[model samples]
Target: MLAALILLSVGIIEIQAGGTPICPTITTPDWGEVSCSNENNVGSRCNLSCQAYFDLVGTTGDAIETSCGFDGMWSTATEFECVPIKCFPEQVSPENGEVICSANNFAQSVCVFFCKEHFDMVGLSAANNAHAICKDDGDGDEIGQWVSSDGSTDFQHPFPPQCQPIRCPTTMEAPLNGQVICSNRDYSGSYCVLFCRDGFKFANRKEKIVFSSCSKEDGHDSVGEWSMPDAPSCRQCTRAEEVQLVALIHESEGDRGQYQVATSMIAKVLTILRRRHGINPTLRVNRYSSSVDASNEVFTTAFTLKSSKREIDAIPYPGKGANTTTALRYMDQRLTGDRSAKIAFIFTNELRDFDAEMEMKARNLVEREVSLFVFTLPQKNRARTWIREQLVKITRDDTRVYALPRMRFTNKYKDEVAAKINDITMTKGCDFLI
Candidate 1:
């Protein structure tokens, strides 16, 4: 019976190993095994083993036992993952440094001192522990200085030095009204003593004039003193005691003629003379009438009597026989032996042959007693050579023959002509000849 029991036991065991059995097979729990009691027999137990867990082993070939306890504690199976140590700032610019932590939980420093072109490392050397600073190369003093929070250095100064302001001399002073002291730059001052020229008088000499310094504030120098108070007087007009004279202007032609151009020119001359020399003179105009039998003779006699003081006449169209003869004879009789009277004769329009005769006769009649002045109109057909020669001869000796250009009739030219005549007559002493 014992032998049979043994055999039965062996079979039962093999069936259990085959994973199926009528009765539970009991065995000791090994690695990767789960222990559980059989359901059919309360006292019978079984061991459940997984191949994957049983294959794991330690370095000594011992099984790696793992257990899940009711307390919820798990046995260590693999090591905790060893993450790499890192730094807050992963990288830094050259000439700068960084701090890092090691896998062993240790801190370390790293400095990059070398910089790129156009930059220089300042401060201390960049090593494992020391901080590093850098700057740009520059020319001015105080170079390599930080300019902004962004780690930039100034290459130049903000402001540069400049030249000083110029100083004006203090020795200069202002001059009086008629006189002024001119500075080096031609600035005048009232404090400067002044003197007037022979004809000039002091207009204002009371207040002292002061000139400000030459600077950007003051633009330029002032013109010096003058003779007049408001305006400096450089010259004054001097009146002469002389006899008044008359000028006859003829506007139309007749038995007694009209001299329009001559009259207009003479009026301008008189105006200039009055302004320049303070002289007042008389002027008259008479028209000719054929009804008057002796019109030529009457006009001649009237002109002579009127112009006796000045002995000047303006004869229009002297070529006309009656006018030429009448004027010559009247001038001869009235101007003769009158050394004080100055005669000025103006021939208007175009000159004729008889003009020469009249000129010669007048010259012979008055001699040095008369000063003749002729105004010839600009014309294409000028006087004959004989008449021109005689006129020139008379003008050279005692007359002024101004041959007005064609342009003299215009307003602009009239002013110029009047100015020229006034200048000549006033500057060059002349008898009161109208």
Candidate 2:
């Protein structure tokens, strides 16, 4: 009887458990159906009994539930999405500043409000998502500036205007022969004149008065005319009365003395006589060299005159000391008798006792009527004053004694000496005999 009662009670308890609610169930269309009996539950199941036993004994509520799809899955209908951040360009610090972004960067569509030329960016480029900013240093014309994209700076002023130098025009007119020159900076017009040779007059004198102003009619572009008649023909003296010139050159070995001056004087005298009367006088240039021996080279060198019609000769006298004395004696004899033969003596260095010999000769042969001119060259180490005194004593009170300083013998002083000779000859006339 006890076994029968135990089995029956067990059977009754099992049948009641099948029909009783052990836990709440969840159902879904995709997951089919699920029971929370603890036999096939996905996770901790929700049931009224479990809830009441934990702490909700008096709570009149449905079973507590837990999710069962996936470990981190949530309903897509209830999920909210996160939005992406965006960046934009800000205003440029300097509005006048220009900007030059990279071509690729620009095409990517980034705002460039703060971008500028020769400036640095303060914000993001197209490659980044940050607000962009730009700062312009300034253009080249500014006090402190930078270069542009082309590596050039703004000019403070336009490039200075280029200018060309002025050039004077070249002339081709004859006589003027392009010798015309501009006088000043006023070269815009014709400003040149023509000149003619001395003694020859210009046909265009009125028009060519100054080189600074020339006209086309004045032969500035063509050969001009001569104002004066053809140059006077150089004539030769045929009569003795026209004029007369005689040169006595005394040369010695190792002593050039004033031979050049004597020759020059003779030339001047002849030129003057010719110009005055349009008559070239008969010239007699005689050279007397002391070293006139068979072996002396100077004996063969004859004195020459520029004129082909004039007579020029060199008389060589032998014996150094005696030749000079003999030449002077011959000159005195010739001049004393022949009134036509004008004479002048150029003495070289005074040899031993030569001065005494000359003084004696002067006293004996030289008369007051004979015009004799003497030029004495001072000897080195010899006083010029003493020589001048000696010359005065020999020539007496005559103006024939001319003592020229040695410095006058140089080539540089040749012109001055020639001028002096001309003055002397012009005033005295060729009739003075010297």
Candidate 3:
């Protein structure tokens, strides 16, 4: 072999007298593609690859290549044909729900969805049309995909059915003079619990509570609804008792309009107490001022509840001064009694001090069991929010305090304000939702 050696390139081998395979032309499968390098002749290997979501028939891998044999034949059992991929038996189903398919998630299979108790199929509107189809993935990938049948294509990602907890219609809420509670107020299978404040009971004296529950019955859209007999209302059972209310109007330079509203609402309260609740409520309206003379006279008493409204002139005075300190001291000395409900309504626009003496005077009011309701301006004035904070500390119970724009004290919100005062008489406070 060394006698006639010709070195054409590095690592070249000597010529031998053996013949290589010359295979025929190879064809590509309908589901795949085939590619060959170096003319597809002697010892050439051809590649076989499937389309998207498709696999080769009777093959364990897609990366393998087809070879040519010495008999001029392509590789055996290496068919380049690809078939559609198979999909789910369980992975495609929704949690707390199920899906039954006609063809078991194979190509051309149809799936119908269902939900377990206390659950709902959220993806579909009605069970009649709750179905999906398994076919070629539309995105150029011939793989199987679940397609919605409701004509709505938008889904979380690839569009599959889903299940969620059923919710009840929002028709009932907390009742007046009582409270309504539930394990889950917004869902089905939730039981409602009702409770009335002291001295109150349901209209049906025999039954303390009505049977109320969220059910999966014939609710609007088959979602869920409250049971037939809704939660009953509560009524005042105990007789109305006497209440002595003292209104302290803290008049300032520009608080005339606010002064007028305070007196007006107080008048409305007197009328409501006498006419509606049959309570012989006594009221005394007084103004607190810081004038030198006011300290001696100590803010002259304006008016007191009378057998007739004509007996007292309910006039709005143009007073000047906001000495709550002086007023509190005077009230501490004046408000002496063992009356059950001694209410003090203080209408002020500002707080003069946060000193210990001032706080002690306010604490005296609370220690004497005086229910103090303080009304002031809204918090639009960032500088004056301290007034509400200071008053809250004095009242001890912030619910007894009310703050709004002075002009809002009109009859438009009479029932609302009156109901709050009414609850005070009950001694149980207001419900969660007024």
Name the top TM-score candidate: 3
lDDT string for model 2 (1-434, tens) is 11111124323211122233111123332212223434322333423222111222223332233432222211112111111111123222334233333321221222233322222222222112222222222221111222222223442321111112222344323353223334432222344444443222334232223343322222112222222212222111122232233344553444444444555555544454445434453334455545323232121112234532133323343335524455456555444333343434445445333467777776664452333555655465554334555655555545556554464543444344334334433323322312
**Per-residue C-alpha lDDT of model 1 across residues 142-178, encoded as one tens digit per residue:** 1222222223233232111111222343434322224
Q: Over all chains combined, what TM-score does candidate 2 have? A: 0.30
Error of 2 at 126 (Å): 99
Q: For residue 122, what is the lDDT in candidate 3? A: 58
Please give the RMSD to the true structure for each candidate, in Å. Answer: 28.8, 30.7, 13.4
lDDT of 3 by residue, 188-254 (tens): 7888877676666666544555557877854225468777445667776543244556667664555
- In model 1, the worst 10-residue window by lDDT is 157-166
Give each model's clash number.
Answer: 16, 5, 0
lDDT of 3: 0.61
List ranges where model 1 is wrong by over 4 Å.
1-240, 243-259, 284-325, 332-341, 354-359, 365-368, 378-387, 394-399, 405-434
Q: Candidate 2: which pairs clash?
A: 98-117, 191-212, 192-211, 193-211, 237-280
Which of candidates 1 and 2 reaches a greater lDDT?
A: 2
**In lDDT terms, how accurate is model 2?**
0.35
State the C-alpha lDDT per candidate.
Answer: 0.34, 0.35, 0.61
Question: TM-score of the candidate numbered 3?
Answer: 0.39
